[model samples]
Target chain A: MSTLLECKGLFKSYSGRPALKNVNLAIESGHIVGLLGPNGSGKTTLIKLINGLLTPTQGELYINQNPVGVESKKIVSYLPDHTYLDMNLKVRDIISYFMDFYEDFDEKKAYDMLSKLRINPGDKLNTMSKGTKEKVQLILVMSRRAKLYVLDEPIAGVDPAARDYILDIILSNYEEDATILISTHLIADIENILDQVIFLKHGEISLISSVDDIRSGQGKSVDALFREVFRC
Target chain B: MLGKYMKHEFKETGKLMIPLNLVILVFTLLGMVMLGSRLLSTPAMALIGIASLTLYILTLFAIFIVVYVYFTVRFYKTMYQSQGYLTHTLPLSTGSIVNTKVFVSLFWVTVTVVFTTLSIIALVYTAMGQEWGKMAVDSDISFLKELLFSFLLPCFSLTILGCLEQLLMIYASLAIGQLFRQYRVLASIGTFFVFYIALQILGTLTMFFTQFFSMDRLFHISENISGDSFIPFYRQLFSVSTIEVIVFCIVFYILCYWLTDKKLNLE
Candidate 1:
């Protein structure tokens, strides 16, 4: 499969302090890549750059060999760490909103998933718990048939059951040929499902390897390696 | 897309305005009742004073609504804050998002203006014991035109200003907010303070320029003009220059679009 996203020597800084420094990475289709990083390690910033939310201070970011812009947005589905749906909006309203804007949004698939999850179409978002809201957001993101799915901390701040459900929903809904780049600090829960792992430290890629390679060659799980590498 | 934006805008604005509208209605009703009881008073000035006071109160309410509309327009920018990540990540261009807000803000302000005008007219009729329609007919043609123009022009100008100012604020807020990742509230507050200070400085400079231009001989039309005459100055201030106002409004809208489309930072 072709590379869906390519970042070369990417650099981003906020208020003259570096958030990301010369980060290099490439993502291909048909793989779930884990973007592992601690807090303030520039995982969100890198995701924002890839999704065209933030312009890079320097270096290049490309989706399908083209620079990030409106075209990139069309192919990228982003799930932010925070809730992005208005509290006043119902589940159906948000679905319709996505449908109106995104040509590739699968309304039927979203509805099916929502119904299976017991999320009512008429339920107001404000009335739902944070975990439910996160589920609804995940449903919206997973419903898209974009080439790249950038999920930033999709399972953060949720109960164990909800986290499992979120992971299951993502696994079930992702298109087979598309790329899912999930950024999270919860290494162990997701380490099993991730096909490839990219460990980010101090705003740079410290390691990138396939899960199988890490397991067979190193004789250790990605989580254990992560703890060893990132140990204080 | 436009319809959906407007529907949400109306719903959001309704949350804040429903109570304010109720208050305005209550005060208007009270004014009518008080005016009706005092109709037989010996002093005519008392009745006129009461009528004028009622109208002034209604005007004040209208101003509040206009101001409310301004903030409502601003709220649309942040309305998606809890969800801005989703909104900015949508396939739609940023231009559409801002346009949706402008249309809805204009719609609500227009609605409020119409209601305020109707309530003020009702208060006038109730307080004066005169048929508003008949009095409107008897009122001088120029006076009526001036009145209509004054009310309508300001409402239109305010709507345009609401659109432009809020768009600028949204862009500025988004750009500045991205500087602080987790603590976005601090960034917003810091940006607001910066914007406020800049606005004050700009206002002062504009006032200075206005004063400078007024002193220029070419700027004054009447060479022998009497500064003592308040009527002519008042008439000029409320002049019904529809064409000029429309052009200015178009310019303001273009500026809003330019700022939002080119300068917005969703990060």
Candidate 2:
């Protein structure tokens, strides 16, 4: 598999405080990777940098060997941690909106997912429960045939059952050659599904290893190892 | 892509604008009916007339406030707030995004101004009947033609240019303000006032310098001057302001696009 993402000495700072500092990493295709970190560990900041929401203070980051830009945005499907959909729009309107901007958007698949979730297409976003809105956003992001999926804390807000459903949807919907980078702190819940795990601490990547390697070498689960490494 | 962006922008803004426009139309018609007719003999009719007129005026005021506030708020909310997660991720150039917004905003503002002007004209036409038309036709033909061609048309164009300049100034201010980590909204408001004051000072300096250099003499004609001289004089005056407005628009647009593309700091 070829490399899908590269960050060389990636550094981002806000008000002279470092959010991500001297981070170098590469992601290859066809694997689900967990970007595990505690709160304020620069997980979301890294995700936003990938999505072009914030410019880097120094260094370089690239997607598919191309620098972060409109072209990179075209091939990356991103789901932010917060509710980003316009509240005044209905579910159907937002679907159309996604379809209009993303040429790779699958309208039929999106509608099918909405139906499975028992979400009416005509329901206004403001009226939907927070979980339902998150589901809608996930469905939209997953419906795109993108080369990279950058999901920031995708399963954080949903219930356990809904989390399973979301994981299932994510696991089943992406292309075979695409890479998934899921940023979350719920390591135990998603450890089984992640082929590789990256542990971030204090604006730096402390560990990057395959799940099987961590289990075999450390003789413990990834979550247990994470607790050992990042324990206060 | 710009077309798609503009289409969505229009749809979103139209939801608020269409209803407001309808209200304006309905109230304008009601006012015409109340004022144009002679149904004010009784105290009740007189009170109704006054109430309807007041409502009509208030609705007109609401149209202006609502449209301006809606566009400004929509720009801030969609581009800087949570919705920015969706907006900035789109596979389009920042220029296209900013241009689509500026165009749609200008479109709606123009519609509101035109609608308000037409509503007032209609009201006056209803009240004056044929007298207004006869008076317009009986005026000095050469003078009327000169006024329309030299003054009114230039003023109309300048009004539009000025509107675009102001809208872009707001956009640039918001873009600069979002770079702040805290007090982003307050920063944006401060940026706007700073830009406003700077522009005011620049305008005053320009006017002062022009007067100092006796540029106004170009437009000051003797009372005995012929009608043909009016066109050249007005054209010169209009060109200076037009060029200035265009420059401001370009500068503001570049600032907005650069800040959005290079220095985006979305929350």
Candidate 3:
């Protein structure tokens, strides 16, 4: 596997306050990596840096060996932790928007996912429930034939059933050559799916290890390790 | 991609803008019929006619205010608010996005200005019944043509430029406000006020500079001997104002583009 994402001394600060310290990371293609961290651990900042939403204060980041830019954004699909979709647009209009903007977007797959969830294509986003909105966002992200998917807190606000369905969709939709980087605190629900996990604490990387090594060598699940490592 | 961005922008903003403009035209038509047709000749109906006229004026103001505010708010929300997530992540350059928003808004503003001018002309022509021309130009077609070319057309262009300048000022202010970690909206408002004050200073300085250069010639126009005097002073004034506004527009646009392209911090 080749390195699809690499960060060298990546750092970000807000208003002179550091949110991410100098850090280094590299992830291979085709792996579902869990960015495990508690609140204020800079997971979102790192994700933002990768997505080019926030400029790094100090270091370098590259995706597919390209710097973060329009070229990088073209191959990276992102789902933010908020209601970031245009609330004024209907689902079909948003689908059209995505199809117009992203070359890798699959209109048929988007519609299929919408139908599976029983969501009307004509429904406005502002009229949808929060859980339904989250599901719609996930569908939009997963429908793209992107090289990398950065999802921030994808299942944090959804119900258990919707979370499971979301995980299923993520697993079923991703291609073998693509990578998924999911940032969340609900480690147990997603532990079984992650090939690797990077634990962040207080704006710094505390640990980065494969799930198999943690399970087979330490004989403890990632969730149990997380509980023990992050116990206050 | 720029074409696509502009097409999407027009579709999104046109739905409401088209109806509002049509309503203004409809009200103008109704006003012309009421005032010019003598439809409200009765005593009580005359009072209703006055109220109708008042309503038409209010409607005009409302449309203008709504257009400017909607454009400003749309820019802020789409570029800085939560929806910015999708906007900033697009595979298009930041310059294209800025261009799409500015040019589309300028197009709509120009349309509104044209419609407003037409409505005013229609209402005045119907109400005054050839008297406006008699009073303003004494039925001299050449003078009227001169007014159109020299004054009215230049005035319209200046009006459009003024709108663009104000819009860019707001954009720059909002861009600068992104530096604040909290209360960004309030910071935007405060920055706008500061920009307004700075503009007033620029205006005052221009006035003083012109006065200082002209001495008493700024107000006193005594020389009536020459056929050619620097293409008329009014034309010169218009040219200066146009250049000033264009400069401000460029500065603000660059500030907005630089801040958005290099220093974007959508949290």
Candidate 4:
């Protein structure tokens, strides 16, 4: 029950307009948590704040009880909403770079993941299709034995087949002791895999419940409750 | 990390630089050819020497432009666009990246200037049939040093300033400009204009203060007011001193690094 991430009264804005407002969240290790929200509901912002990509304007965020900074960044594997990989690098070169910089990067696991996806290490990123590129990025991030994995819209811009493959890769590669916070609007697709779900609406938590609790206590699936709660 | 950073810097820089170096090589070769053709038919050896020297000066100018533009563009794109986000975000300290880039820039500038000078000297010696050394001795070896310093010193100082200015202006420009996605380019230009005006105002203020107070400290102009009128204006270059230049460079680097490290939106 050790906390992997903690956010208290987190606030953020762009150009004086609020993106996130006094949002509080806490996640513990060894759980697959689905972060369900409508578009522009600050799911990505919260993930970004946790990853130290965007500094919070107000309040505090901690990763593994440490403040978010270079140290936190080192232990957090962040898969950004967009591709962060340089398009000019070969897959092998990119792997070497991560292996050189990150202490926790698992080269063997990365290679195995790539082989499973049939992605050649010699292939240039620019030459790969967008879906394949996302797969490569996912492989690289998940190859790390990070304390927490922050995946922002990993399945957004891909084919259904590719999405399933990505999910499978994520499930297989994630360390058993680590936590994962996956932010997406596609709740039905991810509900089966997620042990816990956090529903966000207009930058506030609408619901946070375990899948078993949702089914047993309310006699309803997490997806049905999500649709009911977030109905327009 | 710095070694890897410089390796990529050199690799990417060489892509544009090799062509510029070749252009300087061809200019030197052509100047040599022209001098050789003239020397074959003329008895006026001094005139030939003079003509060769003029061509050498022109080649030096060409060298300066090629290297300056190549480094400017190469450094900007690589440092800002490709590797900058990674560099700024990494656990490494800020001073390391700045120092590495400054050294790399100075390295390329020195290489370009020295190689171009050597190429010109080689061409001159080849065209003049071993009399090049005699010409140098006759013209006083001091004259060659003077010629080099005269041609390169101002350009060198300006090149350093140009690099620092671009580094500062571009970072601030990008930071402010990136706030607006729709008119980012226009905003960048506006920022540059504002920064340029601010720099000019600073320069004017410095001039006014120096003229009012540093007349004695800068010029020792009490010798002869009328005779040393030009000295006050001309010696500002010498009076500002190298320490001032170094301090300004440090300040500019710190400002650039701070803005880049804090405000970067790696979109």
Top candidate, metric DockQ: 3
lDDT (Cα, tens digit) per residue for candidate 2, span B77-143: 9898999889999998888889899999999888877778778888878877689889888888878
lDDT of 1 at A178: 92
In angstroms, the error of model 3 at A95 is 0.7
Q: Select the stronger candidate by lDDT from 1 and 3.
A: 3
Name model 3 segments beyond 4 Å from true: B40-45, B132-142, B216-231
Candidate 4 C-alpha lDDT tens digits along B152-226: 565556555555555555555655665553666577679768877876787677667767766675455555454
Clash number for each model? 1, 0, 0, 0
Which model, 1 or 4, shows the larger TM-score?
4
Cα lDDT of model 1 by residue, A73-147, tens digit = 888888888876778888998898788778889999999998999999999999998888888889998999888
Candidates 3 and 4 compared: the better one by lDDT is: 3
Residue A148 displacement (Å), model 1? 1.8
Clashing pairs in model 3? none
| lDDT score of residue B126 within candidate 3 | 89
Judged by lDDT against the true structure, how good is candidate 1?
0.73
- TM-score-based ranking: 3, 2, 4, 1
**Candidate 1 residue pairs that clash:** A84-B83
lDDT of 3 by residue, B1-267 (tens): 778888999999999899989998898888888878777889999899889888888888899899989998899889988888999999989999998989998899889989988998898788877787667665567666776788888999999999999889988889988778899989999999999999999988886776576655534555542323423666777887888899999999999999999899888
Per-residue lDDT for B1-267 in model 1, tens only? 556656665776677666666666676676677667775466865777667676767666676656554553355345325455665666556667667765665565555555566667777777664666678788788876765565556555655554456444544454455455567656766775776677568656655554465455423545655433433443443343333344444654565455444433455
| Model 1: TM-score for chain B | 0.58
The CA lDDT at A20 in model 4 is: 85
